[model samples]
Each structure stands twice: as structure tokens, then as C-alpha cells.
Target: MNDNILNTDREELVARLIDRPESFTDKQLEQILADDECRALYDTAIQVMHSIEPKLETNVEAEWNRFSMLHSRYRRSQRKWWKVAAMLAVVLMSGLAYATIQHMKQETWSEQKATESIVSDDTTTKTTENKQDTMQVQTSIAQPRTFENTSLDLLVGVLAEHYGMRVQVMNDEAGQLRLYYEWNPALSIEQVVDQLNTFEKVNITVNDHTLTIE
Candidate 1:
């Protein structure tokens, strides 16, 4: 047979193996059993299919009997190949399944870490606000509160809440560093946001009750 024709037949055989392996005719099964390439393709297809969607129950004895009956000469020159193919199918399916589970676990862990970080920061911000309030009560009214080495996010949050405004960090290019400056309670929300805009590349916009940093 021509190489092109053989390849076409092998491709069709592999497709049928994936979609409907049980429907293979006795002649087709015999061809697959005789050809090393076809057997390899069959093993690979079985491995992939089993990995993606595994059956809940499988009868080993029944399946082996059915496969034996499909080709009467299954034991002639292909018995060793059949055994090797079955073993390879099992190992490949197990490996793929393990890899998929590991990937899912990694993604889940990443999401959990992100959630913990956000919650921790929010809790810390609330605690810091409470401590500042306590310190203000003990200190003189003549002294103005100053912010130094404060996270930009925390500073923006404090300003937004105090001025009854909404603060938005619009882009990744925006500053994400600590601030070191004196806080003036008398400054308007726009002036405060302008003070917070320390980065040269960032653009800060204050419109009515909203402040945006990009």
C-alpha cells in the first residue's frame, strides 16, 4: 500500500478509536493488531480519553474477553504488544490525572493567598485608624496629625472616608508607595489627592465627590 493511503487509514482508525472503539470491525481490529503504528495510536487515544473522562466502573475480565473475541488471532503475533499497550495506557492515564489535580490545587492555593492578603490589609487599616484616634485624644489640639511611611492605599482610604469622597486607583502605573508628609485637615479633597499624587508619571483627577489616580 502507498504511504499516503496507509497514513489516511491510520488517521481514520485513530479517530474511530476515540469516538467509538467498540464499533471497530473484525477486519479493522485485525489491521490495528498487525500494525505497530496503529497499536501505538490506539494506546495513546485510549490513554487521553480515559484521562479526560473516566468511567465510574469497569469490568476487567469482561473487557478482556470482548477484546479477545474481536480478533481471533489477537494472541498470535500481537500478545506482547497488547500487554505493553495496556500497561502504557494505565501509566499515561494516571500521570495525566495527577498533573491535572496538581494544577487545580496550585490555582486554589494562589486564590486563597490573595484573599488572605486583602483581608489582612483591611483589618490592619481598621486597627491603625483606631490607634490614631486614641493618640489624637491624648495629644494637644494645637498639633496637626502627620502621616509618615504610610501605604498609599491606606492614605487614600483615610482621605476618601474623611472627605466623604470616592477614591479609585485607576491603573497599575499609579503609585503604590508610602507617603511622608504633614496632614492638613482643612485641605479640600482635591488638594489632598494632589498631595498624594507624588509620582511624576501618574495623572490625578478630582471631580466633585470622586478622586481618581491613574
Candidate 2:
């Protein structure tokens, strides 16, 4: 087509001719049909537009399907990850609870053992004191005498002075002297034995509360 003719009001006519070749007036139609260049340009533009239209449609459909598949997979992957995270959280919580329970159980057992030990030690001390008092009362009337080279009275006196114990020495009907040492609630049996054993001449026997010295 002539550039001037294409630039004038013929552009719309040219577009219309391309849309429908049989719709133009006879004169305009004759002008377009006689110009081989214009006719060839129009035919070529129409063929190009037609060829691209289905490919464009197919490309759009394919892109939409790809986007949908990607979106669906992303959502499924996110859900799967969430489930795994939730399971891990549950396992961590369970482990923490189990460890806490075990720790508590061990603490409780340790406390129980400590309490029992204290009670046992206290009971033993009280029993030793009670027996000593009974022996002292039984021997209070007898006269003090010597046995095993150390006088019973001297042994009792030393215990009284050093350990705050009250001791009494007496002789039984068999003429054998018995020494009764006074009990102290605070004194341990081991402590009492240690003190008495310091004097090698005396032989000592520790009953529940009483320390018998010969």
C-alpha cells in the first residue's frame, strides 16, 4: 500500500477489509484487490494473527495448569512439614515429662532415706540412755569397790567429770563390783565407749542405756 494512502482514513478501511474482505464498497474493494502489495500485506497479517491465537491459548492454559500444580504441591508440602514439626514437639514434650518424673522420683527416694537414717540414729541414742539410767538405779545402794585394778568409783567419777554423766558404783551379793554409768540423752554410745575405753584397767559393757564397768 502507498504510505500516504495507508496513513489517511484508509487504515480503518484496511482493518475492516482484513476482518471481512467481502464487506467493503465496490470502489474501495477494487482499490485493495488491484494493489497486490496491500492485498499480500493484509493476507500475511491475518495468517500470522490466526497462527499465533491457538498457541497463545495453549500457552495460557499450560501456564495456568503449571501454577495450579505448583501451588497444590506447595500447600501439601507445608502441611507435611507441619505434621512432622508437631510430632517432634510431642516427642520433646514427652521426653521432658519423663525426665521430670524420674528426677522427682529420685529426689523423693533420697529424702526418704535421709529421714529414715535420722530417725534410726535418734532411736538408738534414746535407747542407750534409758538402759544406763535403769542400771544406775539398781546399783545405787551397793558400796563402791575395786575391780580389774581400776576402782569402780574412780571410773564412774571420771565419766561424770568428762562426759557430764552421773555414775554409781555398787557390789552385788557375789562380791563382784558392778559400775553403773549415768545416761545422757545427747551422748552417743560410741562417744561413751571411747571415753571409758581410755582407762585400760577397766572392762566396760554397754547395754541399752547402761555402761557396766569392772
- In angstroms, the error of model 1 at 170 is 1.0
Looking at model 2, the pairs that clash are 128-208, 128-209, 131-209, 131-210, 132-209, 132-210
Best by lDDT: 1
lDDT of 1 by residue, 1-214 (tens): 3323345577776677667768766666676657888778878877887798856698999777644443342356866887898899799889868976895676567557757788775556556656875775446333455564555666667777777888888764454655555667677766766765643454667777776766
Q: Give stretches of model 2 more than 4 Å off.
A: 1-76, 117-214
Query: TM-score, each model?
Result: 0.31, 0.20
TM-score for candidate 1, please give it: 0.31
Candidate 1, superposed: residue stretches over 4 Å from native = 1-143, 173-175, 198-202
| True lDDT of residue 132, candidate 1 | 70
Model 2, poorest ten-residue lDDT window? Answer: 141-150
Q: What is the lDDT of residue 32 in candidate 1?
A: 65
Per-residue lDDT of candidate 2, residues 1-214 (tens digit): 4433444454565677878876656666777756766777677787988888764335877677645532343455577787897899799889978976996676567557757778775556556656865776445423332222234556555545544555544433212333333334245556656655543354555655455554
